[model samples]
Target: MTASLPVATQQDGTYPRPQLMRGAWHPLDGQWDFAFRDDPREAPAGVDFDDTIVVPFPPESPASGIGDTGYHLVAWYRRRVTAEDIADAGAAGTGARVMIRFGAVDWAADVWVNGTHLGSHTGGQTPFSIDATDVLDRDGDNELVVRAVDDPHDVAVLRGKQDWLEEPHAIWYHRTTGIWQPVWLEVVPETHVESLAWSSDVPNGSVTLELTLDARPADELDATVELRIAGELLARTNVRLLDRTTEITLHLARQRNGQQYEHLLWNPETPRLIDATITLGRGASEVDAVSSYLGLRSVQATDRRFLLNGRPLYLRSVLAQNYWPESHLAAPDAAALRREVQLILDLGFNAARVHQKAEDPRFLYWADRLGLMIWGETASAYEFSERAIAALTTEWMALVRRDRSHPSIVAWVPLNESWGVQHIASDARQQAFSRSISDLTRSLDGSRPVISNDGWEHAGSDIWTVHDYEADPEILAHRYGSTAAITELFDGFGPAGRRISVGQQDGGQPVMLTEFGGVSYIDQDVEGAWGYSSASDAQDFARRVGGIVGAVRAATPLAGFCYTQLTDTGQETNGLVRADRSPKIPIEDLRRIIAGD
Candidate 1:
């Protein structure tokens, strides 16, 4: 019989310094007892604990220690945390409530601690946090069990690139099962800061700060928020909390009092973020303090161009899918995610259109820390049942709730070109789901803009996002004021000879070459044959991407663009870089075109 891995038994279980968390995160991502069953109802009793597997990484992943025997099944994770852990947390001033946070779990999960059921959640892409203070065994070891179920057959849920067909082909892969995200516990003071929200009104040179606090009736429960410009204080405000939520507005008076006028406003070239510190309390006797920040920028489209902070700013972006063979959805470490960000920065791109799904929180944390603009999207690209729809809607709301604190995410795309949404002509269920997703995202997250659909089939979004795959860049430039190429290679060729057509196309909107390059998998020398076309060489891919950059730049009407992809995904090899994150082509090739050479 295989021995089960020992769970960390310290005062605090284990805190892996996740490369992506803005602050500190206790990583509950280590080994835990796992079991897989054909029917979730036929769960094994606790006495049969030997049938367990690992937590976070799906049973199919190599990291999960279960070989590719292929168990497309449902299971539960069981572990025990002592009351001593909770007591230690309570002793610390930061401790008030212990919440179990899941980075992500596949399909659906229902959690219970110490025999008390917390709640159930669905949607595989977003994070979910639940308060486990009351449910814990305060005096002894507490049993924690997470039951998760994923039906690969269910198409209505948002399952990005995951395939139920076992073998991943073309652009899909084996579905991730069970908890795939960092699971840990955090202790918050009973009267701690619950959430933070920010809005950037660059035109008026002002920002509104919204703080949600725990219900605590202290004599002076006013929250003080201080704003800083490049480590220097610009403005500060103190507002009284009324029912756990309060909004305070701050105006940045004239470009940091005498610095260069251009230096004051945050521009694309020199993007700036105003840091903030929120303190809850009366004078020195503060109850809690949370560090947060916001950017002085806005994303909108005008007759002149896609405006950032009311100024015409071009979006030289890249389509970034947060996936790695070794790590799958989760990054190996925060540094790994940071390295991905550095790769984009090195590629001369300014923004990342987080393709199909929302990324790890740490990825967003790094984006905020690194000044990278992000388009935060929901995993809404699958077709599922009515039960799945209801479950997904709850998951989407929680996703926005957990992520609304980050400022790096400037826009939100809830649905993508209708991946799982299906045929728009006759599916009323799909249309309703699309509309419902848009409404939920908009209502939950009002701080940033939301896109109902990323590529095609616009439901209701701030921008009319259009996806095009024409041979002519100029013709695309005339149409969809801002067009994005969801398919990286147009007409199946590289960047060198791609055309720049003129006249009206795509409804005459600004053009954004969103997706162009794709999978240059690491084993390209061995597996680089393009079945669709004969001209599938590294040079061909390079030439195609290089040409599009030139064509778009040459055609001044093009607002901004994104390459086909940041890395080769599965079998769709056209990336400037390989799937293993090794550079397939030189960065100079892309630099030259982005520089308009």
Candidate 2:
């Protein structure tokens, strides 16, 4: 019920698709009739629409009005689409196609429009759509129904931090079964731009634009793209669209004029985004247009260093669960997503290692504009099997394709702590799975470093990372202060008693203490809340964080370190900030310690 807000009262505001934005789209994020049953074999004939829930928020979330956390395999939702809904999308009156886009639905989703089967989608973390023009009841109201299926006990599914047990336990929390992201409608011209893929070449002062259209182009069809930086025209070109997809490179005028291209580069210090506009037309009149942007940035994993813009950049990062008490996995609002990014940077961390979640695009939008770096990660199935491979592989690929253009994302962690492949250290099949994911990620996006498995047991990785929670500063300093010690440790069982590498250490890759300093501190009583270490007071907490973080910073051979976490989630009280995002200590003091100053 609290999903929609007036267009004002916001900054850069939230839009489902930030990259390809058109002004004529309509939001479908109000209310929907919901049920928890499978009585309907196909569409519209549901057993009952007993409850009304807010769109986008999952039924397990309090914002959804159901707040049901129990295990359920299926959830049904119903709503009515009216003429005003189509009219509000101003572009649909003529030869336009109305597409209903669902930002995400957990596990599996079968949708229907006006009782017509629109087919099903099998992923939980990526966007899918249905061209509903054919099935729309233009003369009257149209009924929209969705049936979502998610098995809580299915270990082969990508559950992320969602607990499969009856109650939340360990680091896992409650499950988000169905309809956890946005649903909206956009009216596109019959020959509109379907997708945009952007990549920047800082060295060449140019950007490569790959565009896909909704249909085959006519003989005289033309597409024009404009690039700008700081309101100054950077590049513009009009290319002929002979096929449905076309690629064009736009070289910036600043680079062509022998000006300093450094000012145009995007980094944490000055996050410069080159704005762009794409237009499709037959001759003079514009058929379709959308505004987009890309950042001129580069990231690399050099031996013993992490490079940003070809400069050695030490990553000060924190693991982000990104869960809210009221909203669970789906962010509470657009402003909340922006606030989380600001909080991470305010604590002196340059990057967020978003653990177990492929973050919302709105979060990436703010990070791209605010100069915060992100290590994008996704959920892993608990077991290694054929089902696990299919589910994880399909979802992960779609996720990568959906997010590869963002400038803030510098790395990808396909698997973490060997969660899905627990026996990867020895099992050949499991090891192959890890390698395949790494290889697949590189094939899709080779611009960012791919960590096959983050903590230990790296089958194929561009960075050698390990998670060690040793509380004593001196012990951690001595353990990782030298390269010889790290190499020796990699030869045997690591801090977690898992093999660090399969055969070789993949020398020349940067080494980092990726997870450490999980010092728990809380002023209030909360049972079962714990961390790797505990502190009694705010001063004690600061001292513990400074000690642990400083130890890793003092390791001369290591590239960087990511502290335990950012905010507390459920029973994990190891956050610099509380569950409600309140700082435990003075913000300045915490920033000083995290910055290793």
Candidate 3:
């Protein structure tokens, strides 16, 4: 069945980078020349493009207008760039450096600007850029070509839930090939802000900001960083840029105009954000400036509870795959993204465990703005190999660096359900690798909690998370009621049976039922529709959901619970909402069950 378009179309000219905004920019969206080939050889100069695909949408998606689900190992895209695009870029006496940024492209991507070879990027889920200033022809139209290659079956590649078979089965869906996010061009000065790292100390009421510049000090340049709240300047500092990076701390607890100020903390209820402006100047002349914002919040976990901003917080979350029937991984528009978050909130969910895929930055931006918590997870590969390990680690690090600044992301989940490291319980090296990754994440950012391997055998995890699909609520409550019940439940277990609870039991750590209640409901008689358990009708689905969630909530020691899913995708007909986002059960009924009202 073909899916209908969303109510609102995505704005064509909306800047892709919302965290850091600059004035001079152009979107490279819309239609682009596309061609499919079997080999990865360079495109022949005279070859004619046979098809057109929409930018930011994968070829396999209906939104791309090219519903080619067949695997194409190599795909090429070409677009024309006119000189008029960069006319107003170099206006401030500073030489303009034009950079073409790709929000995300699947697997591997190589680029050429005016036939000049630019760089290539490997990961499919993170953003990357190519400096096009040197190669673009300012007088005439320039040719831009991109070649992307993806092999979904390759165990080394992190394909997430994209099935390798011709048709999707089980939890896996159709593959997303080529570009899946918006492409745009940005104009910046010779030396610009490359990235910003943030950390907040809630108890001390202060925040530290680390600014990384594109280049080292070319001359004696002074950098000024200012923090403001609702247009009232809180603090400002100036530093001499002698290196590539500088760090500044802004103490929120201070006296301003002989009056004391109280620290405003960010929570799911009130996600307060403070604005920031960074300026680089040579002597008295301003060379570069950028605007950004940050939320002052802290996430910590004690033995028995999860703490947000130093207060005990309970998570009512849903598993969000972030997929659509028409758009596959990409949301049809920004409005659809907002609608999804609103639906989650309306259904009484405060957080989302983003399943498998690393969601779009725009979605995260909304989460930060709308006061929703997120459990950031990496897309895990199925095979265990050196190549897979390296690829997963590299991409996981990139994901961390790309998203660590967002205050909404309270936890980092590196692995889920032992997807890639199946032998982690028996293999020492695999266990060590898991510990290394957990340590690495903590070292990179010590502010948030890290779950090395979620769901079952966890070696190094701050929060002990488990996934149980037992449909009976009585059994679930009996099993998780007390510390003795958990101990006796897994006593004298072998390696295979101990997959659910490996290592020594720790009651001090926060316990969470991360995955449960995948009760299915089929409105129509469709083949291959499945879930953990099937319900006959809407009332039956609601009853089963209430039983499962109510049971988990009655287990008082449990910190939180994440329902199976937010919406249906592919054959997984267990979501609260249908594949097209229509509610399978009444919203109020589901909310009452989820909120334990």
Candidate 4:
């Protein structure tokens, strides 16, 4: 039997984009026609969708209302869009652009509007959009069809923790097929903001904003970018749009008195955000405007310690996979996402290592607003192939571009436990590939640290991270307590029985115990639930947990630690809370243990 669903209300049906908000939007997130095809060659247009599945929830999820745990190579979804959905457009239907946006669809997605193929997207973790303005029928209804193909065994596809077998096992869970995130319709002007990338230098008191605009070659455009803090205009500038992308750097370094502006830095304790706006204009006529927000923060590592906003900080984080017993990978709603973050913070964790999956943007938005540090990670494919490398590289670039602006994200984890490149230490090509991806991530955004391969056999990682499930507190402390012990443990053999250091050594880089202490606490009713080690009862679990956490906290050389998980996932009974987000141990006790009280 599955766990009970969380009693949280759905999001207020607002646009999913919190960083960049548009005035008008239509969320397509209720119910949709769903069909599963055995043959991968099946086309969505030819099939008559007979079954109904909830939007934004995978077919395997109980919340989808079609709980088919079996592998489905191809899945199709059909929905109708009426002109009323885009009626809020600028000119009712004349020269108005209606963009169809999908927060994410697993594996690969082929979209069609009004029987016309708009485009296709391959990445499952990043958002994509298509301008359906030309194909939209303003007077009547339009058919929207999506064909999603997901093959968990195919190493070319980044499947995260999705189990390749027919049933869930170990750390891998059920497959998330079809649209796993929100779908919506947005109306935009001809020359609206496509995307924005923000980079801040808190020490220098400056921020560089890059804007990518959706414009035609014929439309000449200029933009006025303004930075505001509580209604006061901090900086304003204008630039000619000679190209589709333009960047401007706002230096808030000096005041009229030749003194530096006292900048507010963002951290888990204080996540202050500054408002921003970009207005596109043609000569003197304003064509389009978009609103956004940013936070000023910087992350750096020196002397084997992490420095957030120029102050040394220890990361007390949890391994958050963002899975639900009812919805699988999808949250019940936006409020559920916020609740999860609040839960993490309430448990005395200032940060979370969002393991494997590239989480929904709404979670990151809340993390930014509510002050939670996130280690942005990419889903990994198990096998290393030309196709796998291409898929991972493409999706990781898009993921970085999509999430780099958020101040809550302090690091980018490209791979986990050498899942895709397992033989990196022995294989020359795999080692090169690992370094290439690391270099590429740094090139994309140099502001944050990059963990090339998180768990072990590190190739080119900014932070030395290891995963150990040793239940004995003495053994755990002996493994990573001192610099000499760390060097011996990492330099001799790795945690996963592989060679510890590959390309980089355990230099002065900060060392983090990314995974450990998956102590199991199974309810008597829940069969097949297990963790790394079993606990007899709540008292036993608390004693073991306190022992492990106290040992890690006393470790002088270790920079931080992330417990095995925040909540229980399918078959994994190692969560601090159960699958339904109910606490196993007392909240106060768990918080004290995690906080080293």
lDDT ranking from best to worst?
Answer: 2, 4, 3, 1
lDDT of 3 by residue, 24-108 (tens): 6777888999988877766537446799999888999999989999878888899988877666443333576888899999989
Q: Return the clash pairs for model 3, or none.
A: 303-508
CA RMSD of all predictions? 7.2, 3.2, 5.0, 4.9
Q: List residue ranges in candidate 1 displaced over 4 A.
A: 1-25, 42-47, 51-55, 67-71, 82-95, 135-140, 216-220, 253-268, 282-284, 384-392, 426-450, 459-464, 468-509, 517-536, 594-597
Worst 10 residues of 2 by lDDT: 1-10
TM-score for all models, in order of appearance? 0.82, 0.96, 0.94, 0.95
lDDT of each: 0.62, 0.86, 0.81, 0.84
Candidate 4 C-alpha lDDT tens digits along 450-505: 88888888888888888999999999888888889987866678666977578686
lDDT of 2 at 446: 82
For this target, which candidate reaches the highest lDDT against the unseen true structure? 2
RMSD of 1: 7.2
lDDT of 2 by residue, 1-597 (tens): 001211111227577888877766678887999988744254567357899999889999899999999988889988888888877764564678989898899979998887788879988888998889998976689988889988888899898899988778868998998898888887778778898888877777789998998878866788888887666788889999999889899887787554677888889989887777888877877788878878888889986799998899989889999999899999998799999999999999999998999888888988988989999899989999899999889999999988998999999999999998988877999999899999999999889999999999998899999999989999998889988898787888888888889854567899988899888999998778899999999999999999888888889889888888999888889999998999999898999998955
Candidate 3 Cα outliers beyond 4 Å, as residue runs:
1-13, 44-47, 88-93, 254-263, 489-498, 501-507
Q: Which clashing pairs does model 2 show?
A: none
Worst 10 residues of 4 by lDDT: 1-10
